[model samples]
Target: MTERTPTPMDLLDFPGAAELIAAGGVEPPSAEAVDGAWAAVARAAREEERATMPATPPTQLTSRRVRRPRRLLVAAAAVAAIATGAVAYPVLDMGGEPAATASASEFFEGMAEVAEDAPATTPAYWKVRVETDNQDDGKRTDTNYFDREGRVWSVDADGTVHEPPAGEEGKVKKWPVGKKWLTWPQLEKLPTDEKTLAAHFPKDPNTRFDQVTIMLEDSPAGPELRAALFRILADTPGMKLVGDVRDSKGRAGVAVEITQKSWVRLGGGGGGGSEVTLHTRDRYVIAPDTGLLLETTHKTLGKNTTTPADRYTWLEVGPAERVE
Candidate 1:
């Protein structure tokens, strides 16, 4: 609503802030609170545009401190984009994990920002070499080349080939954005401007969260769209910076986590009268410098315990010339 990127100055807009400043009534934040307050400010910037004492995020919000100087990458619409206030609080679970320290905006900006400062490209096919490791099953890696019309040519590790169904030649695979969906070409056609680009997504934050992950992992989005995708996630609440980490492949990347909470009812006998909370976290490791998603680790956090779930490590991802 403000149509401007919120800044430190916004803190002064707190109802009694001016009075406190005039009366010298406000207490200076100590060292520990500053980091927490800096994080509190970023969260407040997205939620209420008001400051909170004790430097705690709203109960519904779970945030981590990001380092300073998250500059504006896409200056044109970034102002409007960052000002999207009152985004819904997200559902997630966490353990005594490390205090999140990277800024979502900065992390995305780095990735959104390289290939000639991220020059545009229109490759014939979107290529991805990914490994999916299931907890039940083992690991399987495949290199897939996808055309604009939704056809895929996948080659397995042992040299077997997998192609799309015979009858579906020109039909494209549509990825869900929110309630709606978009084909690969439509994804490319999405407006580059952040405000307009953001309008294309649904208001449901969880829907926005999952769909964004899917598209980024699989779609052949261009530089601009790729940048916009990061921007969307940056603005979306619930991302906790896990700081920098190396993927399983030993490639350097920045990692972040998002948690989702659910509950299941027990059935029959002694446990039948009870319910339990299931808190699952999805952690993503992406090479911001090269703008490639390297790995994703899903974990289930229980009473002071963390259990591993599914994991996906991107072996290779880039543009392709053909679906061969």
Candidate 2:
């Protein structure tokens, strides 16, 4: 009779695996959670293989060279461990100072100063490309090209080019821009002063930080706005530099992270609310010379492990060719 491969729990019964899982967290995962996590792992692996399948060849003007980052590999490995019912996350030291050591104000202030003087041009079309990976969603890629005159082109993961729907000539599918969705012009019009910028975003520090991060991460802000955005980040509470490090693409830059905890009322409105602290960390990788954003990653702190919330890495932003 053929022997079946051991599941994470099966391995735990033998030895070593249980200890590792125990070390990963104070409380071991329930059996149901482990099984569900393993299923996710299986699905993720299959999806990854499908993602690697050859697609319709890139256009002559387009290139398919993707510089997947080191952190992405780390996330993938984490998923791999989950297949066996163990999710082990090692300490990630990209060889730099902790978030506490660097100056949040000075770093963004530096980015602001450089960005203020950088050149700006209105391209015929701006293409935004990004790769996103989530603990549940696996990995997906997309490209969005938009022109000043309301033309849009979207390239999906399968290399399918989607255009505007019927009667939606001027409007294509909206970019998957997060919370603070601002177009190029609106972004340019944003207030540069830190105090005014704060007023524009949410009053809640955590929400404001996330909004600012989304703006910086996804928007094709002009040089002036870019500088202003960095300055705004500098002034945010809990924002600090995490020291210089290289991105997955080997682009070296300083990393900054904002760690925030918010007290939430646990009970119903009428009930005396118990305060629960919600923790979130947002990190940004910025090019030292130009102050350009390289990458942004979000994680939620947990008792046992830091949850891999979301990661956004820009692939390109430039003039598109062969516009219809």
Candidate 3:
């Protein structure tokens, strides 16, 4: 009897063979199409592997004997992860009514209460600090302030005041610094719902987002920090609503987690493709009296890739004031 070795196409089943042919075509496949085709091949491979493998082999299956199936399983999992947004960490749900929703609302109301208790005749200002970490790029910090007159100013780490760009008359211009500003109204303008948020704050936007400033707290939780948090929350989808909880700061807040899978474009030109799974957790603290946002913390995780999770905190909450 003569044994016939499997051809490349035969070794892959119909879908896998088709994928190989398509990938090696005269032109590269469209990223969307390539992703779809890869998923199909992975599913087919999984089914075939399962069908061919005996439930109870006469002998134990060694790594060598099970290599093909194992490889197929891994590939299938990866494809599936991309097809569905799979995040490395859990994301809190921002949608639907949860126990935390009531708590969140209560916290906001509380902030309002605190504001009402303060002297209405006295002007209020919000001081903000922002810290960003881009994986290997280390960390950078920026601080700013929002005053009662719908104006924003930059503050150095040591509390040195740097006025926003001013006109010939020394009036501060309203534009964001380097096109970025932070304020309560600006943060409120951002969508919290999943669908609209994703559309508005895409990871890669063709146009830059407008930045504004609003004052909330005298501490680190400022308008700039809130704006950044809103951006991060908007970019991440599939967050599940957890509930209201207390943080180390003894603040009452709402917590949410999301496990998302998404296709991240590679290269600076936005011409390449890569898929990753991310898990993110975020918590929002509202003024227990005023219904204003007080602070936030965000954490993210990515699996089977070099991408690292990010963590940061935002603070400041006060009377609801708008920044132009």
* Cα lDDT listed for each candidate: 0.64, 0.61, 0.42
Residue pairs clashing in model 2 are 69-248
**lDDT by residue for model 2 (1-324), tens:** 999986656534433444555556445554444434433443444466557656755564231122222323333443335444564322223234222222355556667767776777767677778877878777777788776644567887677877755564557322222345556556666776666766777765566667766666655667766666776666566665567798767878888887777567888688687877777777788878877678877787869766677887776755555443
CA deviation > 4 Å runs, candidate 1? 1-102, 114-116, 168-172, 265-275, 304-307
Model 1 quality (TM-score): 0.64
Number of colliding residue pairs in each model? 2, 1, 49
**lDDT of prediction 3:** 0.42
Candidate 2 global TM-score = 0.58
TM-score of every candidate: 0.64, 0.58, 0.36
Angstrom error of the Cα, residue 54, model 1: value is 42
- Model 1 over residues 97-143: C-alpha lDDT tens digits? 32233355445645554322565677888788888887677788878
* 1-324: candidate 3 lDDT, tens digit per residue: 899986754545533345444544344333444334444454455567677777866677642223143454445444434334331322235443122222222223223334334443223655555554557656666665666444567667676776755555443313332335534345445553334444543242212222211223232233323434343433333333344666545667655443333345555565656554454544445444343444445456545555544533344433433321
List candidate 2 stretches off by more than 4 Å. Answer: 1-102, 149-152, 157-159, 167-181, 193-195, 262-276, 319-324
**Top-scoring candidate (TM-score):** 1
Residue-level error in angstroms, candidate 3, position 32: 36
